[model samples]
Target: MISEGRYKNQKAIIVENENLSMSFLPDTGANLASVVLKEENFEFMVQRPEREYRRVEFGGDYVEAECSGMDDMFPTIDRCYYERFPWSGTELADHGEVWNLAADVNVKGDDRVDFTFHGVRLPYVFHKNVSIIEKNTVRIDYSAENNTDFEMDFLWAGHTMLQAEPGTRVIVPEDCTCAQAVFTDSGRIGAYGEEFDYPVYRDKDGSLRDMSVMGERQKDSEKYYLKYPLTEGMCGIERTNGRSFTYRFPADRVPYLGLLQNFGGFREMYNMFLEPCTSPFDRPDVARLMKKNCVIPPRSAYDWYLEITVR
Candidate 1:
């Protein structure tokens, strides 16, 4: 079944099965978007938002923002501000504000397509859209198009938040190395000048704690890359024991993946932001310096995919 509603300034799409219900909010305020697949003893919430943060709290589940403002979404050691190209005068508002649903999406069951404004860009047009293909393994395809005549820069990242606890552990394919952690507060540190191999761990009072606390790192890297064929993606925090879940993105389409941890104090709420992007945040100047930004030609189309499966 399918249902539609409005929450704040955003629009939501709800899909359900015999055992579960899924909601998709195109607006940034609805940070927790995508599938809510549940069956028997399993339940999972997959998030795919541009930016998500909270106020008056160090960590909880991030509140999606209406616009890119100082107090809106807060970037973490894992997730950061994703800026698209062109130039609209406003930072967060650069991508436009409305989510346009294709007429066909109103129909229910299995196959559906939806498009979002994704904000605005000055001289050009920037928008992100998702297409859902339902099956044993549901498919979510993403794409960002440049409607203008000039080349545009694109930064597509996923702020995937997960719920966790003290006993919660992460599992990633062994060959995958932990990339440097980018803190929103400290700007860019660690691998200041170059990219290096790093492992995933926790910081106690700004110091690296015991690696064992990170659970077991996979011994086989090949198995990890098996899911993501084009680029190397990491999987941490296995959900086998605790209330855990997994989200997958097309490795070839989304070259990078980011895993984030958020502790809710009582039960421990963790978020794994699986970012699929052409570049990382380091300022436009830095992106230009590193030659990391993707130059999307006008009138051209680029496509990507994300999948959520709850067991």
Candidate 2:
């Protein structure tokens, strides 16, 4: 079934089959707010905190209200100036320009839906399509086009967070090694940009810290971007109860996978993020410096896709 509805006081569109159900927010960032299994009622996506949500006025921040759930990061993740790109302006906002704006939702047939957003600050258009390909798998296809007469460089990432507890196991490709854990005020596991093997890192004090799971680490907050290439092109996290969520995407299209753990840190929220990004770094400027930013020619389009399965 397909229908329009409201979730968390925000406008949303829902699509479902016999086994899977998903919700998409059309007016706000076009976020895929929720995904769940029907019979078991097991939700796979992390939702925003339960509170009265008010639309932010101009110059107000939206981060405080829309931090959880799934979001699309485009153009850039970190704010910076545009250099080399045709656009002569500052980089995209905190999490990019889409989240702050509304999107147009189109229901394609019974099993597919598309959410589209046109850029305001830059000359570009982004489209995302969600389709239930199987009873257990949902496929997401993304396309971004440059509407200008010059080439543009940008970054894209699927900002997906999942509800996790102490026993949730976060899995990555076997080749994934060497990670950088971002430091935060609450406390950090390692230094910024410090490279260490996956799931295990030596702290400055020579103590080994495990990154494989978010376990009983209260007041701990850290962000890690893995340096290892996605040799297997698949990763996931499974709860201790045996329920799991797996993601599959081509490594050539999305090169980096980021792991964000906020255990009673960062506004006292507990959730973990399994992100797939086209570039290794989040900042456009940093990506440009590293020569990893994606390029779109004038009037040309770029396309990629990923799939998620509930097991």
Q: Against the true structure, whose TM-score is highest?
A: 2
Clash tally for model 1? 23
In model 1, the Cα lDDT at residue 170 comes to 58
Please give, for residues 101-205, the per-residue lDDT of candidate 2 as tens digits: 688888988888888888877778999888888889989899999977898888888888888888788989877767866565444455666676777766658
Model 2, residue 276: C-alpha shift (Å): 0.5
Candidate 1 residue-wise lDDT, 1-311, digit = tens: 55676433456665555645555664432234444445553444433233442222222223432211111121112222334434522342222122211122333344453543333323333333333444324445555566667665544554444433345565555565545444322222232343334343344246553321332222211101111222444343455464444556655555544444333321232333333344454233344455655555788756666565554
Predicted structure 2, TM vs. truth: 0.93
Candidate 1, residue 106: how far the Cα is off, in Å? 4.7
lDDT of 2: 0.78
Count clashes in each candidate, considering only residues at least 3 apart in sequence or on different chains: 23, 0
